[model samples]
Target: MPVPLIWLIAALALAGAEVLTGDLFLLMLSGGALAAAASSWLLALPVWVDGLVFLLVSVLLLVGVRPAIKRRMQSGKGLLDPAKALEGKSALVLDRVARHEGQVKLDGEIWTARPHVETDVYEAGDQVTVVHIDGATAVVAKIV
Candidate 1:
């Protein structure tokens, strides 16, 4: 069997493994295998030279390019959950809310609420801004 054919098979196997893993490391190794294949089949290089080409390309990709790929993949903020959607949104007070107790209608649904500032109170029909969410409750402040 040709040395290039062996490299080609190894490349294909590594590429398939890369698909399953989702990490770029295996893909870099597959790229190295492809370089070895090219060196053997295209350049007709000796076995030692082809092995060296593979090792160089694979190490370069792993050390030089992998971190940038991982960083780009992780740069974006993750999708917001429904509760996070209410952050800084205005809501209507459904019941009088004091230091530690209140109710408000947010996005057409009633949620347990509390004044963000202990000294502030929200009366029924008052508008409040949801500052944050604490488990099942909305921490709100009187809309200025």
Candidate 2:
């Protein structure tokens, strides 16, 4: 029946839902609920005030602190790139890429590739650059 207990329960429930759905929103709300519960216990605030505090704190944590923490932890590196990645670099066509089937060699590995433009055709040993990646196929363009 205590406000803190209720808030704690709500927080736990929100966190559990986040785990299930994998959405960041509910997880932020959970942090807010926990903050409200803490405010209730530490400040001995009324139930309504506790609820308001939870809302405020949750919003602050989700909007303000969470992004800062995420940025701080970020290494500016993508998950797929190990050494030089296929995002903004160049590669060479090892074999002629036909209408729907082609292969390229990049970073010493042969990868299935495709031309970005539908009409563009590439020949073997031509210099190509990785433009974009679609699933297993890397979209490539002729490097001048």
Candidate 3:
């Protein structure tokens, strides 16, 4: 096979592996292979020169480009943990919830609860919204 055709095949293989791994590292390598193919076919470069071009492109993309691209793709795309998902969810106070301690029924489970604010309080049977979780406690505010 021609040198360029070999490079193209390597690029395709790397790209396919990247899809299965879901990591950008192989994708960057595939980019380098594509560059090598271009150098071989378009520039008609020697094998050694094409190899050098591939190395430079791959290293540059892996170090400089991949991180920024990953960050952009991940922005606002974090998966919520189950506990964090409880924020803003409604709950029923099982005991008078004071700043220090109490109990509430949240997501069909009993959980330690507390008022969101120091002066805030919730009597038993009160409806509340979980503001956030602090350690093992759910900080909550009155529903209305």
The lDDT for every candidate, in the order shown, is 0.93, 0.84, 0.94
Q: Considering summed lDDT, which 10 consecutive residues are worst modelled in model 2?
A: 75-84
48: Cα error in model 1, Å: 3.3
Instruction: Give per-residue CA lDDT, model 2, range 1-144, as digits (tens).
Output: 888889899999999998887546788899989989999988997888987988898888888977876786585755665433676678888888766989998877888998989788999988888888888788888887
lDDT of 3 at 73: 84
Quote the positional error of residue 138 for candidate 1 in Å. 2.3
- Residue 79, candidate 1: Cα error in Å is 6.5
lDDT of 3 by residue, 1-144 (tens): 899999999999999999999879999999999999999999997999999999999999999999999998888757878778999999999999997889999999999998988898899999999999988899999987
- What TM-score would each prediction reach against the true structure? 0.63, 0.50, 0.57
Question: Model 1 off-target regions past 4 Å?
Answer: 19-23, 44-46, 71-85, 95-103, 108-112, 117-123
Any residue pairs clashing in model 2, and if so which? 32-58
Kindly indicate the candidate among 2 and 3 with the higher lDDT.
3
Clashing pairs in 1: none
Shift in Å, residue 21, candidate 2 = 4.6
**Which ranges in model 2 have alpha carbons more than 4 Å from their true place?**
21-23, 70-75, 81-144
Model 1 lDDT at residue 78: 80
